[model samples]
Target: MTFYAFAKRIVSPILKKMYRVEVKGLEHFPEQGGVLLCSNHIDNMDPPILGVTCPRPISFMAKAELFNVPILSGIIKKLNAFPVKRGGNDREALRTGLKVLKEGKVLGLFPEGTRSKTGKLGKGLAGAGYFALRTNAQVIPCAIIGSYRIFQKVKVIYGKPIDMSELREKKASPEEATNLIMTHIQQLLNENR
Candidate 1:
């Protein structure tokens, strides 16, 4: 099996058991096509939780610092995680993300760009919106509920793709697109929380 599949198979049950993870609304996910998967960032485990629960493999843009760690760097690379420089525009990272989507793959990203200490959703950065507008890929907004406290119920909710036809027609800016993405995520949080 591929590394992603292998890793998920080994880790999924462990994580599910450890956190009592409950994944909902997975039926909203598409079976094929490029997808820009956007989610709210709460904890570092958020990505892994989403990855395990998702039916498809997701190429994620992680903070560049994590790549500095030798063992973690190698592991995350194998897991299809790329490094992104936070607090500034990283052209290389942006290009990588575009390439993933153009190649008809799922590009997972945290719209807020960083973990929220308050466990509340934050305003989204333009990166998620940029991907949504630049590619033909559908934008799927997800919400990760509950802290990663051991034995606590952690839920991952995948919402339906945000309709971007109107935004595309208007040539909406990245900021505008991000607004819609964040709005859907917030709605999901409100509904699911």
Candidate 2:
């Protein structure tokens, strides 16, 4: 079995039981096609929670440092995560992300670019916007709340897909696109209040 299949069948149950994960708006995820799933970063747990919550298989860009760790590399690679340099634009990582989308797979990203130690959303970095502009991939804005603590009742709300067709003809600055997507994510978080 594929790693995702293995995880979905085995690890998924454990995640759901352990965290009591509650997924809302699951219908929002498109049944098929390239999709960019953007979420507010709250903790290191967000990605795996999302992977288990999402109906489709999601690939991610993890920090390059994780890949170098003893034994963690095999596990992350098995989970469909590739390595990306932290704290800056990793050109190769960005390209790999684009390739995942072009191949019609779901690419999961934290537009805030890093875990929010303060438990508040951070301003989005440019990588998400760059990918959205280049591939025109449908963007799914999501918010994960109450995941900073283990075994907490975590909730994941998926907003409707954001379309970027308005920029199909015009060139959009990466910063502009990044804010646009982040705004949607922030809105989703606001509603949870």
Candidate 3:
């Protein structure tokens, strides 16, 4: 196994035991090939939690600032995470994400753009939708609950992939497409709650 795979194998179990995580719909994840895992952001722990629990290597677009920290950057890189600027146009980050997908690897995205302090979902960003439309990749909608609460057993629900073919012909704008994606994510979160 690769270093990351080996590290994940070792670290994942430890994290599960430490956090007492409960994940549902893991079978919903694609058994193979490149896929986009879109989820709602609740806290900083969301990415690692999803990463450790999921069966595949999920590379996420982390803020550029995090990568500037020497120690944290090393850890983030080992976890298959990449850097993206918070504000302004981050074309490089988008390009990097696309490259990962092109290499047939999974890419995890938070459509909300940032963490939700209230544990409530936020409006979706167009990057995820654009990626889906451009690559024709399967968009797996995911919901993470109770992650905002410390010492709580967190729950993660993975919904069936959203078919982009249906929306491919629609006249909706990028923003509209993003909203549609968020709506589906919200539905899954609501149903689970």
Candidate 4:
């Protein structure tokens, strides 16, 4: 069996029992492409949940520190997670993300950059926007409500794929593209509420 399938088979049942996650909009997920799934960062479980819940395999840029853990490093790597340097512009991480997408895989990203300990969404970082525009990939804004509390009801809503073709055609600045992407994410959150 494929490693992803194995991992998902193991993780999905546990998460489902503990969190009771409700996911909507599976239809919006593109069948194939360099797609970006942009989500808010609220809880540590967010990444793993996305990996399990999404229809396609999801590759994410995890904090480099996790990779330093002896056993965890090997496990997450096998699960299709890669490390990104925490503090600055991580070019290597960006390149790796591009490579993942270029191979027509789904690249999952957290627009807020870090976990919102307060559960309040923060300004979207430029990375998701910049990457979507640069790669001409479709951005699907996702909202996870009440995921911070374990063993509670969590709702994950997937918005339609965002078309940012103009950004690529115009060669927009990363900051500008990022702002647009953040807006879409914000809209999704607002719509859910």
Candidate 5:
């Protein structure tokens, strides 16, 4: 196995045990293939929580600023994260994400762009939708609940995959597609609540 794949396999279980995490809907993941995991962001821990809980290596797009710290940047890179500038169009980051998807790897994206302090799902940016269309990858809507509460048990609900082929065929605008995906994520959160 590749280094990241092996490291992810070994580290996830240990981290889950240490954190006392509870996860569901792992079976919803495709046994093998590329996938775009679109998740709600409530806290800084959300990414690692979802990453370690799922049974595969998830390549996530982190803010470029975070990588400026030498030690943390190295660690994040080891964990299969790439950087994206926060305030503008990041073509390079988008290209890397697409390349990962095209290579049949999982790419995790926070559609909200940043954490939601209120614990309510925020409006999603169109990047996830755009990536899905560009790569024709399956979009898996994930909802993470109770992650904002300190030391509390967290729940991650993975909804069924949404096919992007139809969206591409209809020539749906990124805004429209993003809204649809966000609505689905909200519905998943409601179901868990």
Candidate 6:
């Protein structure tokens, strides 16, 4: 098995026992085709929680600074995580995301761009919307509820694909599309949390 699967195997049980991570609406994930998993960022464990809970393997983008650490860089790389420059336009990172989508893989992204200190949803960046507009991939809105305290009941809920048919023609800007995506995520958070 690949390292991604291997890591998930080891991490899954630990997350469950320690955090009691529960997932819902997994049917929203398509068995095949490219999919963009857009989620709210709350804690550092969010990515791994989503990864182990989701049915499919996810390729995620990490801040480029994380890649500078020796052992961490190697591990994240093997886990299908790529580096993305945070503050400015990183064309290479965008290109890598497009390539993943084109190959019909799942790309997990935190549209908010960073973890929220308040544990609330934040403004979304345009990257997720940009990918949806550039590809045929479906955008699934995900929300992770509960703090990452040990023995806490954390939940990961996946919502249905956001309809991007209207924006696919470039009629709407990426920021506008991001608003729609964030709206869906907020709804999920409100209902589930």
Best by lDDT, which number? 1
What tens-digit string does per-residue lDDT give for candidate 2 at 57-144? 9999888989989798999998899999988778899889999999999999998878898878899998988988999678999999
The Cα error of candidate 4 at residue 179, in Å, is 1.6
Candidate 5 segments whose C-alpha is farther than 4 A from its true place: 1-14, 148-151
How displaced is residue 56 in candidate 2, in Å?
A: 0.9
Q: Residue 177 in model 4: shift from native, Å?
A: 1.6
Cα lDDT of model 6 by residue, 1-193, tens digit: 9998999999899998899888899988899999999999999998889989999999999999999999999999999999999999999999999999999999999999999989889999999889988999999999999988999899999999998998987578889989999999999999997
Q: How do these models rank on TM-score, best leading?
A: 1, 6, 2, 4, 3, 5
Q: How well is each residue in 1-193 modelled by candidate 3, as lDDT tens digits?
A: 8767888788888777777788988888887777889999988888888988788888999989999999989988988889999776799998998888878889999998999978889888888877887675678999988854545688888888887776777755667667778888899889988
Ten residues in sequence with the least summed lDDT for candidate 2 = 145-154
lDDT of each: 0.95, 0.88, 0.84, 0.84, 0.84, 0.93
Which lDDT tens digits does candidate 5 get at residues 1-193? 7767676678777656665677778888876678999999988888878877777788999999989998999888988999999878899999999999998889999999999989899988989888878876778889987744545667888888886677889988888788888988999999997
Tell me the lDDT of model 2 at 155.
87
**Could you give candidate 1's per-residue lDDT for residues 53-157 as a string of tens digits?**
999999999999999999999999999999999999999999999999999999999999999989999889999989999999989999999978999999999
Candidate 2: Cα lDDT at 91: 88
Residue 36 shift from truth in candidate 2, angstroms: 0.5
Location of the lowest summed lDDT over 10 successive residues in candidate 3: 146-155
- Candidate 2 or 4, higher lDDT? 2
Model 4: per-residue lDDT, tens digit, 1-193? 9898998999899997789888888999999988888898888889888887899999888999999999999988988889988768999999999998888899998977899878878877778876887685778888888854678888788889877877778888878877876777777778776
lDDT of 5 at 139: 83
Candidate 6, poorest ten consecutive residues by summed lDDT: 165-174
Model 6 ranges with Cα > 4 A deviation: none
Q: Residue 27 in candidate 5 has what lDDT?
A: 80
Considering only N, C-alpha and C atoms within 3 Å, which residue pairs clash in candidate 2? none
